[model samples]
Target: MTKAYFILILTSFVVAGCGTTQVKRGNLGKVIEPQESRLILSTKNIVSVGDVMLRAGEYSKEGIKLETETFNLKDSQTTSVKHKQHTFIFSIPSGEYLLYSQNNEGSYYASEQPFSGLKGTKDGYGGLFVPNGSPSATEFYWNWNKAPNVLFAHQAMLLTPINGSIGKTSSALKNKNASIPSATLTYAGVASAQVRFVYKEFTADGYARPAFTQEVSLDYKPGGTYAYKSALFKVYKADSTSINFEIINPLY
Candidate 1:
């Protein structure tokens, strides 16, 4: 009896203020007009060109309830900085805001729960507002994780599994005394075989533990299709010792 071994491999909330700088502005018999405060949105890492949405207040499932604006990074005015990073500048009222990011294809990549914008500096002028880190927002760093996985834009993403072990299930046997399973196409006159499947989860740092696992007995013919949970695949060949299958929806 022969056994085939098939291996398949697949892969914070903080609100702080920028230090205020005092500037002396003499108002000697002169009326000083109030200038709008600027909020600098800079990113050192981005997956692709897409719209960046910012809404007043914190993120909620029912939505912002107020006016929400989206700015496309491609169309927004940006300035080049050191290390080829881009900085997006926005003039918004002083308040808390939530940020949502999505790719051009409408796939969400990142989300920032709540950040603040201040209106005054030590100089008694419009102050520059930013996240905990100024000039570079670490929350926008999408490339932090090198693993390939889906990105959800709404809220914090859950961890996923990686380097999952392959699971096998068989239904029939030909020789009771056979020490190993056979791959000769048929077993005990049964036109069925076993196929191995794997489960995976995604994470920002790397991968997460398996969401779940269950023991199931499945029988399929050569070149047949099957579905297990959200995974769909077609069996090209299967036997007691080895099986070959193709994932129909790899991204699902």
Candidate 2:
């Protein structure tokens, strides 16, 4: 059987009192995955603020199935899905598609490419504020017990760059939080060799937080490469300081 490698890059940022700081960071290089099989990415002390969970589901044109398992990176075994909101996870099947997400309150927060009706705007304090594509926002409470304000957004394409020719339909932000929107593209019938997982969260106080944006490139005949970009911003309360964060894959 052939061996597959999964690459993941986890980066985080915390902004307080008008200053930014980088906390607990590392990269999981090339995790081996068995061919014609499925593997879960696991880690220890990987998430500094909250628990890192994985949710998987098959992609279709109509919609996606929410009945998926939530796996913990700490343990390589299947776990329970505790969150009531839409759980985020990446399941690749050697194809291309557009990825997007929203906040619990039914707000469109993030996307791989620039999206209309959900762009960040400057607030009264000259801070850039962006809604989570929902009426209300959700919080991602890490192990530190710090409930970091969280938002959901996704990018389009599997292992290919989104070209301008694809037109406006190439990327879009959905209002409904649970609606998982994705698109599949063909690649010479060679099958996609790898899958990339990218996500970003922006606060309401002019601060952008980075969660995890990594690539899991599968090993197949004549292996291929993928590239993409993601951006998120946050706005702080009147008496609070805000920060912004941006995560770029391949960093090239």
Candidate 3:
């Protein structure tokens, strides 16, 4: 058996979000949807060598509005609609980065922590799970309670890096990257309460990277469907997440 790591090119759709502030970072710049998200790379920065860490949603649910109704306890009522919309603000100066995704084959381990989508490694359904093919402009949410080892809720997006050419990164560069030490990438938004990120690294396939969980939607949709566009949770990235990951050249 052979393992294959890949960098695939895919199309993107841009959606501009109104500028806002992130709780963790305070005031940032324009809000970026999955399309507007990109990696800022340069010949100078070593720590900035990957796509922006995907931002977690302040609100767990999207495209759902509450309809206001007045119940007279005996008669009828009137109502309005209210939906929670939040923007992800980036403070980390945009630069070189690689898009990261977990959960291919839609691996949603209710008991597995990190929900790093690595259980496939043990089950032998190919390898680490992720988007087995091209992904569309859709939002992904993880019932953190359902994601094994996860204690929070999270809304994640499937995206690509601005420049995607992470073929073989030499062990020397990986060594250098290791020496550089990893820093936490952050965005900004003030969470009301009941949310925080616990950072830890997990090894899957062959690459080792930090894994963290944030609270998103408290509600879990068990039947494999969202209220809005039914994006396939099983497939996340455009490339197959299976295959052995041999770290000949490592890029984060």
Candidate 4:
């Protein structure tokens, strides 16, 4: 049992506020069989991008019926809109569904706590004045019957537009603007697999102090959709330790 699990990618959570959605995935009635129910949307780019959200839903047990896809940049010769790489094909009825992404709203699709940054704000602005060494914001789980049955929710970003020099420190022009002025919104929540970080020692009734920690799951399987095949999560440490949460994704 060599499970360490100590990985913290952090810095991503300006969450839910881009505006726009017509709602479609067979209108959420869930029934798209392109060859045995498959839904994929996670370009797996690595870097260089912004403002591209694609969410789909259906996984009921009293939760997860999401629907969001609002990425626009139509061009008529030149208004500056070079956004391409969209592959969303869905076929449902096999049961269980939920997808997530919001690469521009800073990042999203948290699975029930552990995405601190809550858009971050303990005082002043943006969790310890954001800019690389992010201090907070990481609580994703935008509600999908509580989210995380996992069909997909892969967000990739690399927003760049740092135009505001000369005594510039308006907090880096507010962490982003002018189409993401100096930004970043990486996906894979927070990782370092290798057993990451897991420390448990029981026999309490003594000393204990823990703050800021979120991760309900992860180990790989961030592959592609149709509910991939693996990448699952479930880490509940209670007995008497004070660590009762962990739920990675994929596995549909």
Predicted model with the maximum TM-score: 1
Q: Please say which candidate is ahead in TM-score: 1 or 2.
A: 1
Tens digit of per-residue lDDT, candidate 1, span 120-215: 211111111123212322122222223333232112111210111112222221233232211111111113344433333333333333453233
Over all chains combined, what TM-score does candidate 3 have? 0.17
- Tens-place lDDT per residue, model 4, 77-96, is 10011113222221111111
Please report, in order, the local distance difference test score of every candidate based on alpha carbons.
Answer: 0.26, 0.20, 0.22, 0.21
Lowest-scoring 10 consecutive residues by lDDT in candidate 3? 241-250
| Candidate 4: RMSD to truth | 30.4
Q: Which portions of model 3 miss their true places by more than 4 Å?
A: 1-86, 91-101, 105-130, 135-153, 156-166, 171-252
Q: Which runs in model 1 stand beyond 4 Å of their true positions?
A: 1-211
- Best-to-worst order by TM-score is 1, 3, 2, 4
lDDT of 3 by residue, 123-171 (tens): 1111111233422212223331332233233433323211112221111
Which prediction has the highest lDDT against the true structure? 1
Residue-wise C-alpha lDDT for candidate 2, range 90-204, written one tens digit per residue: 2211111121222232212112211111122111100011133322212211121212222211222112211111111221212342232221111111125332233333343
Clashes of 1: 7
Model 2 spans with C-alpha error above 4 angstroms: 1-61, 64-175, 178-209, 221-252
